[model samples]
Target chain A: MNAAFALIARDVRLAWRHPNEIATILAFFVIAASLFPFGIGPEPQILARVAIGIVWVTALLACLMSLDRLFQAEVEDGSLDLLVTAPAPLELLALAKVVAQWITTALPLIVISPIVATMLHLPADGYATLLLTLVLGTPGLSLFGGIGAALSVNARRGGALLALIVLPLTVPILIFAVAAVDAAIAGLSPRPHLFLLAGLSVFALTIAPFAMAASLRQAAE
Target chain B: MNWHRFASPSNFKRLSARIFPWAAGGAALCLGCGLYQALLVSPPDYQQGQSVRIMYIHVPAAWMAMFVYANLALAGAATLVWRHPLAEVAGRAMAPIGAAFTFLCLATGSLWGKPMWGTWWEWDARLTSVLILFFVYLAYMALNNAFDDATRGARASAVLALVGAVNLPIIKFSVDWWNTLHQPASVMRLDGPAIHPSMLWPLLAMGVGYTLLFVVLALVRIQAELIERRLGALVQARLSAEPAA
Candidate 1:
């Protein structure tokens, strides 16, 4: 427990010092979200209708952009070997790194999403659901992306391969996440959908750490 | 009694050669009879009428498509756990074939949907997940080829195959999870197939045909992948024999 927390603190400190990393992720999110309005024109009705999807899709892409950093830097710098050799279970340490990653990537996106939603002319009611879904869904993305990053750590051109592997697997998470928000926007109860999303996050959280640890071991070989 | 004897390249070559012809022949016979029974001997759909005939091709192809992916996942797990050399070969052989079956399922499904639903595609949960499964298959194939080192590629792609396996059950039950236009299982229910005996036989025959076809194709391709690996090794060996100019 202490080792994992120590590892998480180390990663968070590293990311905290590297503020530019978080800046780039937020920039990508804003730029991607901004494009949707221009592409579809300034129709508030259309934008409102698609607001949940646009936010979720942009969030997915932004998470994807920063995923290469999840394990790539550690793998390259020899830190991963040291971490794996340490007394803590590899899965626990990897989960800590994923925690640090989601904080840097998905956390900022959640903070800035309301402004993005406003730009897209989303209704005021959509805010509560929109925030809730991203809060629930983005961690799932980080877990899955961490697995992908670990798998591709030794491969050349791993960025594209990571997307290929991670995107399809993240489908269910995205579907339920977006559906929850959409249901709420329609005045329907989003609890069932939110519960499913939470369940998915827990599932991913439990399983992906072991998978990521195994892949790291393979890559470190 | 000799478990490790099959580990020899020469032994595997001899064994695969002995079995390929029989597997291929059985595949062909099963497909022919299955198709005949399905298309000609079966009763038409009560609701969808003649358009339901497409189920003979679509359902079975879709089932085999998922089946082959499961086979790849199992092979990947075996390779990782047992370090069985044949497991890697089995996964590589299955990828393209699985992609082809997924493609067949989507194509036949679209054709069937066009007639019955008056559209080529819809965003129903089943349809969407099946499309995602198709993409998953394509991604496996892409990752399989993306690496310069074939062994590295095989191992990495094997891990990916394992990842995609996690998606199969989700795809299978997507319809039940949500209100989907695609009907729930009529044949694969827990109790028994809800289908009538009158309509059931042809579906069973077609299902048998599809399963046989998948096995035959998989075995043939597995043998071919073995030979391809051997041929590559031979060429490399011959080249290494010559000094770099």
Candidate 2:
């Protein structure tokens, strides 16, 4: 557990040095959300209807955007070999890194979501559910995106390839997140969709670290 | 008589060369008879008329799409667990073929949907699920080729295929739920309501034919990949021997 904290602290410190990584992801999310109105007409009703979907999708994309560098820095600097060879469990360490990644990336997306929500003219009633769903959903995005990051860390042009590998897998989270917000707007019980989103997060948390560890070990080999 | 002998690449190559002809023959015979039965003899549906003929191909292709992914996942497990070289080869070689079948399923389904549903595409549960499956295949193929080192690429992709296996059911479930919630004016029949014996026979025959066809293509492609790897190794060896002219 101490070793896992150490890993998390180290990753958090590294992310602090490169604060632009988190900034770029947030900027991307805001920009992407705003693009929908121009592409389609900027009517309030239309944008309000699509606001949750656009926010969820662009947030998903922003999570994917930062995934490329999740392990590349460690792998490139040869620290991944040290991490693998450590007495501490690599899977535990991987989970820590993933937690740190979510903190730096997805957490900010959750924070900035309301501003984008208001900009896209989201119904005031939907805000609570939007926040609730993002809280539930972003962790799953970070976790599954970790698997993609580890698997493609050794690839050329890995960012684009990472998107291809990760986007399809995140469809369920996207669907449920949007559904929960939509249900809230419709005055229906959002619990079922929220529960499913939470379920997906727990599933990702359980499996992603081990999968990342396996892929990281293979890439090193 | 030992089954493990086929695990050896040379032995596998030789056996596959011999087996390909028979698989191909079986595929051809089944396809010929199935298409004849489907197009010429099977009664047209009272509801769909001639468009029902597309079912003979679309349903079978969809079945093969799912079957190939499942087999590929098993092969991926074999590769990862036992470091079985042949299983790695099979997994790598089967991905594109599986993707093609998935693409065929989508295309034919689109063609079938137009006449029946008034729209070329619908976010219906089964169609959406299959579309996600196709994206999964695309991701697998991209990951398989992305690395500088071929073996590492294969191993990474094997891990990916395994992860995809774990997610497949959840994806299907979510899409089904979404469809039920939306319930957009249901038009196309999901199970044919009641499949007549005449339509069912040809469908079964076509499914068998498609599976056999996939096996033959996968064997041929796996052999080609093995030879390609060997040739790459040989070229590397010869270049090292020449010593920087």
Candidate 3:
């Protein structure tokens, strides 16, 4: 357990010193979201209607941008091989890495979404549902994305391949996230979508770590 | 687990060769009868008209699309649990063919929809979910091809196949689960088919035909894959035996 925590803490410390990693992802999210207003025209009514989708899509892309690095760096550095052979459970190690990934990548996206949301002119009431969905949903993205990352570690077209494999399965999260936001925007209550998101998150949280770690172990062999 | 019986590739090959023709013959007979009934005998949909003729192709193709994914998932599990090399090969061999069928389902559905619904495409729940299923098929193929390492690619693609399995059910029930333009299942209902006997008989025949065709395609592909893998193994062995350059 400590080893898993230590591994996560080590990654955090490393990520902290070289915070450029998170910076680039946040930059990409902000830049991508900014492109939408120009592409779609900056009418507030239009932006407000489209804001939830824009935020969710940007978040999805931002997560994709960082996925290749999730396991590749460890694999390249040879730590991944050692980690696979370690006595401690690979699932714990996988869980911690997913935590580190969400913290570094998705956590920033959630925090900065409000700023982007404001740009799109989302009303005050929509904020709760937006924030709630992002909070609940992004971890599932990271955990599931982690599996793709692990599998694609040695692939020739790893990055795009990871996106392809992960994106289809991730639709449920996107569906509920957008639905939750749309529900709030219409004053129809976002509980059902949010609950579903929460359920999916819990499900992903429970299974993904083990599944991803096992896949990584197989890849390493 | 009875590894020796299957471990000897020669024995397995001989057995598959003999069984292949039998399976192919049976599948063909079923499919031929099914198609005759479906296309010729089954009455056209009251409203959909001749376009409903496509229901025979579209519904069966859709069923096979999901069915193949189920096969991929089962093959993946077989690899993981039984460590059968054939499992991975079977899984790998089926992706492109299965994906083609999925594409056919979408194309045929679009064709059927345009004449009936007066639209080329729709965001209806079943259609949307089927679109997602198509993406899932694409993803499986992409992940399978991504790795430079063949084994790694196979393993990665297997996991992706398992992940994509969730969409199969979503596609199947999307109409029932949500209010969608695409109609509910009329053929494979719990209380027998809602389709008329004249229609049901032919649809069943077509369904049988498609299933047989899928089996034939799968068998042919699997055999080719196994032979390729063996050749690969031989080449590697020969290369390793030579003195270092």
Candidate 4:
């Protein structure tokens, strides 16, 4: 447990030291969401209808963009070996990295989502539900994305391959998250969709760490 | 029958060779009968008319898509848990075949849907999940070959398969909850089949035929993979034995 916290702290500190990485991801999230209006026209109703989906998808893409560096830096600097060989459980360490990643990347995206939602003309009723879905769904993204990062860390083509591996797995999260917000915007109860989103996060949490650990062990081998 | 003995690559090779002929012959017989019955003997649907014939292929291929993924995951388990060389080869060999079946399912489904659902595609729950399943298979194949080191690729992809296995049920459930337009199970229901026997028989025959065909293809692919690995090993051995190049 202490080791997990230390791992989290170390990762957070490292991320803090390089503020540009976080800034870039946040910029990508905002810029990518803004591009949808240009692509499809700035019609308020059309933008409102697609606001949640656009935000969710662009956020997913931004998260994916950041995932390439998740373990690449560790692998290159040789700290991955130290982490693997440490007395701390690798699964716990894996979870720590995921948590750290969520804190650095997804959390910021979540914080900025409402502003993007507003710019996209999302229904006022949806702001809360959008934030709720982002909070619930982004961790699942990071968890599954961590598995992709670890698996592809040693691969020749990491970026495209990581997206290919991770995107399909994230379908459930995207469905539930978008549905929850859409339901809220339509004046329907978002509870059921929110429950499913939460369920997916829990499921990913339980399953992803061990997968990450196994893939890391193989990559480090 | 001692299973452990056959875990050895050479022994497994011999066993697969022995089984290949039987599997291939059975596949030939079943597929011939199935096609005959499906195309000629089976009654057309009351609602769909002759277009219902596509179900004979679509349903079986869809079943094979899921079945092959399940087998691949099981093979992945064998590879990771036992570090069985044959399991690694088998997993690598099965991925593309599974992807092909998944593609067949999607293509045939689209053909049937155009005449029935009046659209080539719908974001129906089952269809969407199956599409995602197709993507998963593609991802598995991509990951399996991404690395230069064969063992590392195998191990990494094995972990991925296991992760995908864990997600498959969730994806199925979530998508079903989201929305559904595709018909529910007609044959595998607890209250026996809802499909008529005239259609059922041919579909079942085709299902069996497809499974047998998969077995034959798998055996052949595994044999090829083993031989390829042996060739690689021999080349490596000769290169090492040559001293400074």
Candidate 5:
């Protein structure tokens, strides 16, 4: 537990030292979300209808963009060797890394989603539901995306490969998140969708750490 | 006489070489017979008319997509647990063939959907899930080739294959849920033995043919990958033996 917290703190301090990384991620989310209106026309109805999907998708893309960075720096600087050989359990360490990723990547997206939601003219009532689902869903994204990041850590050109490897695995999260928000918009109960999202998050959290650790071991070899 | 002896690269190579010709020939024969039965012998669907014929290709292709992935995951498990090099080779060899069948399934499904569902695509559960399966295949193939060292790439991708195996069930459940949720009247209804006995036999034959083709292709590719790696090692050994220039 102490080792995990220490690792998390180390990652957080690194991010704090370079705030621009977080800023770029947030900016990318906003920019990607903004492109939708221009591409799909500025009509209010269409904009509102697509607002949740656009935010979720852009958030997903933003997660992918940062995922490669998750292990790339460690691998390049050769610290991954230390992590691999550390006495602390690798799975716990992997979980710590994913937690740090959620803090740095998904947290910012959650913060900025409402503004993007407003810019896209989403109904005010949907804000709470959207936030609820994102809170439940983004951890899954970080964890699963961690698997992709670990798998691609050794690849020379991994961005497109990372997307191909991660996006399909993320389809369930996307589906449930969108369903919950869509239900809210349509004046229906989103309880089931939210429950499903929760289920996925729990499942990802349980499995991703071990999987990432295994992949990291392979990459380090 | 233990079967495990064949797990060695050299023995597997000889075995695959021996089986390749027979599997290929059987696949060819089955494909010919199946197509003949499907096109000429089976009666047209009373409702879908000629378009129903696409099922002879599409359904089997879809089945092979899922079947190949299941085998790939099993091979992945074998690689991870026992570090069997042939398992890794088979996993690598199967990826592209699985992806091609998935593409065929999607394409032929689209062609069939156009004349029947009036749209080239629908977000129907089965179609959507199968599409996700295709993505899974692409990801597996991409991850498998991404590393510099062959063993490292294969092991990394084997881990990935096991992890992504979860997607299969999610796709299945999502399709079932989506189907019930929407339950549209205009969708292609496939409930029971909607297909006649004659059509059924042809479909089964095609299914067998596609499976045989997959086995033959996988064996050939796996052997090729093994031989290529061996050749690479031999060349490296010779080059190293020559000393520094």
Candidate 6:
């Protein structure tokens, strides 16, 4: 547990030192979400209707963009080998990396989602539910993206391949997250959708660590 | 009989060679009869007219899509858990074929939909999930060939295949819950068959033919992979020997 915490702290600190990476993701989130009104015409009702979806989809893409560098720096500096060989369990360590990644990437997106939501003229009732879904759902994105990052770490071309591998795995998260907010907007109970979103996060938590560890091991070899 | 003996590449090569002819012949016979029965003998749907015949192809191709992914996942397990060389070869060979089946399923479904549903596509749960499955197959293939090292590519893709296998059912379930416009299953229900015998027979025949076709194609491809690896090894050996000389 201490080793895992140390790893997380280190990763968080590393990300903190490089504020531009986080800024780029945040900027991309707001800018990309803002483009929809132009593409679909500046009609408030249409933007309001589709705001939650735009937020969720752009957040997914931003998460993918951040993932390409998840392991690249570590691999280049040869610290990945040390981590693999460390006495701490690789799976625990992998979970630490994912937690750190989520904190660095998805958390900021979650923070700025409301601004994007408002920019899209999202319905008033959906704001809380949208934030709630982001909290519950983005962890799964980071978790699955960790697997893609690990698998593609050794590939000659990792960027596109990583997105291709991770996006399909994230479909469930996107579905339930948007459903919850849509339910809230429609004045229906969001409980079932929220519960399902939470369940998916828990499921990804259990499964992703080992897959990430295994892929990391292969890449380290 | 020691099944482990056939896990050896050489022995597996011989074994697949023996099975290929039989599988090919069975595929030919089944597909010939199935198409003949489907196009010539089976009656058209009262509502859909001749377009219902597209189901005869779409449904079977859909089955093959899921079936091939399951096999790929199993082969992925064999590669990762046991480090079985033959499994690695088989998994690589199967990815593209599975992808082709998935494409065929989607295309034929769209063709059917244009006339029947009045739209070429709908974001229906079944259709969406199947589209996601197709993307997963593409990802598997892309990951399988991403690395210069063959073994690394194989193992990395094996992990991906397993992850995909676990996610597919969840994706299907979530999408089903989200929304659905596609018709419910008529063939594989817990209650007895739903469709009439007249249509059921040809669909069954086509399903069997597709499976046999997959087997024959897989065997041929696996053999080709083995031969390529052997030739690669020979070239490497000759290069090394020339340096010494």
Query: Which candidate should be chosen as best, given lDDT against the real structure?
Result: 2
- What lDDT does candidate 3 reach at residue B77? 78
Off by over 4 Å in 3: B1-8, B166-193, B239-245
Q: What tens-digit string does per-residue lDDT give for candidate 6 at A1-221? A: 99999999999999999999999999999899989998999899999888899999999999999999888778999999999999999999989998999999999999989999999999999999999999999999999999999999978779999999999999989989998898899899999989999999999998999999999999898
The DockQ scores of all candidates, in the order shown, are: 0.51, 0.86, 0.57, 0.89, 0.71, 0.87
Q: RMSD of candidate 3 to the true fold?
A: 3.5
Shift in Å, residue B191, candidate 4: 13
Compared with the true structure, all predictions reach lDDT values of: 0.79, 0.90, 0.79, 0.89, 0.87, 0.89
Off by over 4 Å in 2: B1-8, B237-245
Please list the Cα RMSD from the true structure of every candidate, rounded to 1 decimal place: 3.8, 2.6, 3.5, 3.4, 2.6, 3.3
Q: Each candidate's fnat, in order? A: 0.37, 0.86, 0.61, 0.94, 0.73, 0.88
Worst 10 residues of 1 chain B by lDDT: B181-190
**Clash-forming residue pairs, model 4:** none
Off by over 4 Å in 1: B1-7, B41-49, B171-199, B232-245
Per-prediction TM-score: 0.89, 0.96, 0.91, 0.94, 0.95, 0.95
Give the range of the ten consecutive residues with the poorest summed lDDT in model 6 chain B. B181-190
Q: Where's the lowest-lDDT run of ten residues in candidate 3 chain A?
A: A202-211
Give model 2's TM-score versus the native structure.
0.96
Model 1 scores a C-alpha lDDT of: 0.79
lDDT by residue (A1-221, candidate 3, tens digit) is: 99888888888888899988899989898899989999999899898888888989999989988888888899899999888988889999988888888887788889999998888888777898999999999988898898888777877777888888788767778878887888787889889878878887887777687678868887788
Candidate number that wins on TM-score, 1 or 4: 4
Candidate 1 lDDT over A1-221, as tens digits, reads 89988987888898899999889989988899999988998889999988878888898989998988788899888998898999989999899889888887888999999989898888787799888989998898999888888878867778988898898888778778777877887788999888888888897887888788878887777
DockQ of 3: 0.57
Q: Using DockQ as the measure, what is the rank order of every candidate, best first?
A: 4, 6, 2, 5, 3, 1
Measured with DockQ on alpha carbons, how good is candidate 6? 0.87
lDDT of 2 by residue, B17-128 (tens): 7888999999999999999999999999898899989999899999999999999899889988998878888999999999999999999999999988888997879899
* TM-score per model (chain B): 0.83, 0.93, 0.83, 0.90, 0.92, 0.91
Q: Give stretches of model 4 more than 4 Å off.
A: B1-8, B181-193, B243-245
